[model samples]
Target: MTSFQDKAILAEHAIRGVLPPTPLQRNVHLSEAFGADIWLKREDLSPVRSYKLRGAFNAMRKVLAGDPGKADFVCASAGNHAQGVAYMCKYFQVKGTIFMPVTTPQQKIDKTRIFGGEHIEISLVGDYFDDTLRAAQAYCADIDGHFLSPFDDEDVIEGQATVAVEIEAQLGGMPDRIILPVGGGGLSAGVRSYVGDRCALTFVEPIGGACLLAALQAGGPVDLRKVDTFADGAAVGRIGVRTFDRLRDVSLVDMIQVSEDRLCITMLEMLNIEGVVLEPAGALAIDALKDLREQIAGKQVVCVASGGNFDFERLPEVKERAQRFAGLKKYFVLRMPQRPGALKEFLGILGPEDDISRFEYLKKSARNFGSVLIGLETKRAENFDALLSKLEAAGFTYTDITDDEILAQFLI
Candidate 1:
């Protein structure tokens, strides 16, 4: 086997020929907010709008280099990874077939098709990525095509290490800390291997898909009972064996689990304030800085901006989530007396800043009262406190369901 350092350096040199190094730019907003020298490793600027292309290119090049007869490659992905593999297939002039979940957005499907051009074929199968991955593996075996894992493979991990290679070179040395957004562990593991404790490492994962944290707790990789796919790029039911092996000893204290809703706010802030778009997974590391504000203060820290393949259609949902997470929006089930002046009285109770976004009568729970579902928005989160206080003073009964995931999914 080739040495990891050798493979990573080889990837850095070769990839530089394919594309310019992604910038390591100092972020003024983030630096000021964290009271630290915050730099963003903008992998979001990569040709595939992600760092996945690094791994895909490395893995494919090695396969064809070792076995010149290899002509085809296969991979399963829901978002960035598929496009990365597709783009690399075209670059290598190798035949490729990408399997994606049927639930994948049409925009992503179109982008993947555009990247691969005539060098690839796409098959939409399964509603979930796990099912799609299985079908892809079976088809790869049947056709004798080399299966390219999005992570897990040694070459892929080595390729991802090139990210660290560039970071160190671009920064002139390792920073005081490097925060990495982890999926199946490839990027985290690769960066971990490259830094080798010279710089402190913080692994960031979406709370809904914190497979790395689960693995650390179980002493090995374990399949999660359920995974929230909101952060699709980093959401994995199980961490990869090879990748986890490298990350097995990572400290729990160094891992930051970012809630899906909380991450939505970070995504929006980057897009609106920084004018840099980031996918959910891409925002994980930057989100962690909120939790690590004290720890990273006055230190040189780097946050990996993992990807930027966000669909504009999802913008509304992202805004809703961000608002809810920040407490600027909420949902409530109110019991209203079935009388003409009841709503008017309730409306009068609302503060000047509080606005009702959604109002629907759910059902008549009693002869005199009806259950009403209400979605409220306000300029300030604290305004809800005063508004709710006034509602109670007016003899209104309401159930706050903003934080209730299951209830919101059904009722809201």
Candidate 2:
């Protein structure tokens, strides 16, 4: 049996004919910001714009090597994984049937089609990923097609380990720390298996979909009651059993849960500052840097930029989340007196830096007062405190709905 490192080395060699090793560039901006020698393992630059293709290619190559006639493959994914499998199918000239949730963005679906071209067929089934997965598995079983798991299978894990292999070669040695963004734990497991205790390892997950954190807490894999699909690529409800087995011994302290809103901030910063487009899951490792700044100060750190398959259509939503997280934007429901000058008075209360992004009177005409829905954006978070003070001094009754999730979801 090949050892984990040996399998990773083999996988790397197998894939080199088709795909080059992704760049491992030192990011001066991030390094200066964190006071560390920060290097980005640019998995986002992969042909499929994610590390998923590495595992997909490795697994398919192994399978086809074993049985030259095995030509049918199947997988279920909402985005990244579908693209990876589709690209690999096209490369290997195998017939692939990819199942994706109906809610998946047209951009992702179209990209998958482009990647697979004539070798793949896409089936839009079910409303959610779980439903789509079930459909894919059943179709695979019925058709006797090989079902490719995104992260669970050993071959996939071994394939993902090639990332570690490349990193070691590129950096000439392991960094002091490796930050991995965990979804189903394929990348994290692979990297951990290869690196072992050679360096510190940190696993990050979106707070809304912290399956690995939950698993560590429970001492086993446990399904989350709900997952926030905002970070669709990393919104897995549960960690894979095989992945959990590989990572079960990892200390829970090394796992970090990042909020979806915080992820938006990271995405925006990367795009605006670095000109880098990162999907929410891809931003996880970069966002984790904030929490590890002190620990990694003056140390060499590697953050795996997991994916860059971001849809530009979501830019507005991403900006909104980033603004909200930074406290530079807010929503409020204000009780305005039913008077001609009331609106003017409220507007006057806003600081010079404050800009009203949204304003709507909930009730156009009320007996004594009208409820006004207002969205405010300011230069700094501190601007809100002054604005609120001014509102209070002016005898305005208002409810800050900025942090009120239920109200924001219903009205904002």
Q: RMSD for all candidates, in order, please.
A: 1.2, 0.9
Question: Relative to the unseen true structure, what is the C-alpha lDDT of residue 111 in candidate 2, on a scale of 0 to 100?
Answer: 97
In order of listing, the candidates' clash counts read: 0, 0
RMSD of 2: 0.9
| Worst 10 contiguous positions by lDDT, candidate 1 | 2-11
* Shift in Å, residue 2, candidate 1: 6.0
Which one is best on lDDT? 2
Q: Please write out the lDDT profile of model 2 over residues 39-102, one tens digit for every residue.
A: 9999899999999999999999989999988899999998888999999999999999999989
Q: Which stretches of candidate 1 lie over 4 Å from their true place?
A: 1-3
Point out where model 2 deviates above 4 Å: none
lDDT (CA) for every model shown? 0.92, 0.93
lDDT tens string, model 1, 1-412?
9777676888899887678999999999999988999999999999999999999988988899899789889999978889999999888888999999998888999999999999999999999777999999999999999999989999899989999999999999999999999999999988888789799999999989999999999999999999999998999999999999999988899999999999999998999999999999999999999999889989999999999998889999999999998999999999999999999999898888889999999999989999999999999999999998999998999999998889998987
Residue 15 of model 1, lDDT score: 84
